[model samples]
Target: MQRRGLLLILSSPSGAGKSTLARRLMGWDPTIRFSVSATTRAPRPGEEDGREYYFRSRAQFEAMIADQQMLEHAEVFGNLYGSPRGPVEAAMAEGRDTLFDIDWQGGQQIRNSALGRDVVSVFVLPPSIAELDRRLRGRAQDSEEVIAGRMAKSRDEISHWAEYDYVLVNDDIDRSFKQLQTILEAERMRRDRQPALTDFVRGLNREFEQR
Candidate 1:
């Protein structure tokens, strides 16, 4: 049966392993498209335009928002970031799933947008605050002040856990990834997603009547 595409949204506080999980998911299913967001922030070293991000200027980013080209957008750490609606909708129309690795605010916006019916939102939580702190520090990419800021913001992010359709505590990467796979498989089987099922069931009923 041909199935309609879905939007799989993964949201989590920084250092909770959502980004790691997102990469793993794409590796597991190369057909899954990652929604490349447009960001106003300057590209980091080795980051390329339209690869890591769209890398737009603040004015360009705001213009996209004003023109309603963004599927969802939010300001974070003094920069604007958003998913472009065109590519995502086009992928979905061609029966390809799109994965979004965004924060809770962006997740909420997408989940409430016109395409909400096709969205499956998941929130990842850390096992403990201390562990979350440790993970941030372990990254060694941020300063003490930056890590401290993320730790504080994490509490607010965690508060929106209940807003997600699924919540996973990412204590073990392997186990969490397995659970994510299970969720994706099950959601793909949902009745509404499989439009071909209608014709299949009708044929079954006709065969039963003839028999």
Candidate 2:
């Protein structure tokens, strides 16, 4: 049956494993496309345009916003970042889901956009604050100050958990991933997502009348 694609929005605190889960979901379904965001920040070494981000000048980024070309946008740490609307809509038209790994603010904007009806948002949470801190420290990728800042921000992020369609406490990666897969599968079967089902049911009704 022909099915319309959905936008899967995953949001969580810094160490809550949303990024990890997003990667797993993509691996499980290779056809899913990741939403590449546009950013005004200069690319670091080894980062390529369109792969890591769609690098744009601040003026160009603002122009996109002015023209209503961005699905969602935000200023973070003095840099502008947003998801371009064109590519996501195109993917949806082609029956390809787009995955978004963004924070709560971005998720909120996209969920409230014109494409809101097609959005399925999930929020990931840590089992405990101590576990969250442990996971961040275990990565050893940040300085003490940076880790502290993330921990502080995590509270605010967790506060928004009730806003999501589904919430997963990511205490176990494999278990959480299974739950995510279930959510996607169930959502795919929703009557609204599969428009072709209407015609199929109509045909059945006609056959019944003929019988």
Clashes of 1: 0
Q: Taking the tens digit of each residue's C-alpha lDDT, what string does model 2 give over 1-211?
A: 8799999999999888998899999999998999999999999999999999999999999999999999999999999999999999999998889999998999999999999999999999999999999988998888889988988899989999999999999999999999999999999889999999989999999999999
> lDDT, candidate 2, residue 52?
93
Least accurate stretch of 10 residues (summed lDDT) in model 1? Answer: 143-152
- Name the candidate that leads on lDDT: 2
Reference-based lDDT, each prediction: 0.93, 0.95
Tens digit per residue, CA lDDT, model 1, 113-202: 999999998999999999998888898878889887888899889999999999999999999999999999999999999999999999
Give the distance in Å from residue 37's predicted Cα in candidate 2 to where it truly belongs.
0.8
Q: Pairing residues by index, what is the TM-score of model 1?
A: 0.93
Clash pairs detected, candidate 1: none
Model 1 misplaced regions, further than 4 Å: 208-211
